[model samples]
Target: MEEVYGFEMSDGTGDFFGYTADHLFADIWTRPGLTDRDRRLLLIGMLAGQGAADVLGIQVPAAYANGELDDEALREIVIFVCHYAGWPQGARLNSIVEETIAKAARRAARAGESS
Candidate 1:
């Protein structure tokens, strides 16, 4: 979970979280065939197509934080996906991507200042 999402998961025991931890992240995400970057691109496209802005909000930031994507790649994804996903969804995705990059830059600036 930490590697994939750039965050830790709690040991939550319910069916949903358990399945997420034990199956989705542990089994599927860690599988050998696809790199995390490949998965992230596929997932971003799917989510953008479905107009899943909220989840994209989470995923875009995680991709940036995990170094699976960079500013240019993330920006290009918005343009490419928008062509297929439509302008409205592209608008939403663009907002999320830009905000995520800005937030990451701000965080880096803060860390540097602290150092």
Candidate 2:
């Protein structure tokens, strides 16, 4: 497979062209003032709006890496945002939150086994 610019280019995995992804995509993703949990929420909302489900899967689990977010906490965020952002946006976020919650549990379980 040809390494298109920096990404490991593959036809089956994804068809990202690399220019928008490599340069602009990587930079504006993780900004300051946003905790890992906050970043996860923002990304999930944006992904939902744009119908970017693939990236949502990759990011949702990351917030829980530091244990800063939990199932209940994310649920609250979803609830709060729902009141203002409307049900459609909230539903999308809720689904991703559920996915993240599960991911957090799995990671915690693995950590417990190690110790």
Best by TM-score: 1
Query: Hey, what RMSD does candidate 1 come out at?
Result: 1.3
lDDT tens readout by residue for model 2, 1-115: 1211223435433345465555544654445675545655666567666656567555555555445566777788778767766777777777888877776688879999999
For candidate 1, lDDT tens digit of each residue in 1-115? Answer: 7788888766676899878888989999889999999999999999999999999998999999999999999999999988999999999999999999888889999999999
Per-residue error at 59 for model 1, in Å?
0.7
For model 2, what is the alpha-carbon lDDT of residue 84? Answer: 69
lDDT of 2 at 79: 87
Backbone clashes (count) for model 1: 0
lDDT of each: 0.92, 0.62
TM-score of each: 0.93, 0.53
Model 2 regions lying over 4 Å from their true place? 1-17, 25-41, 49-54, 66-73
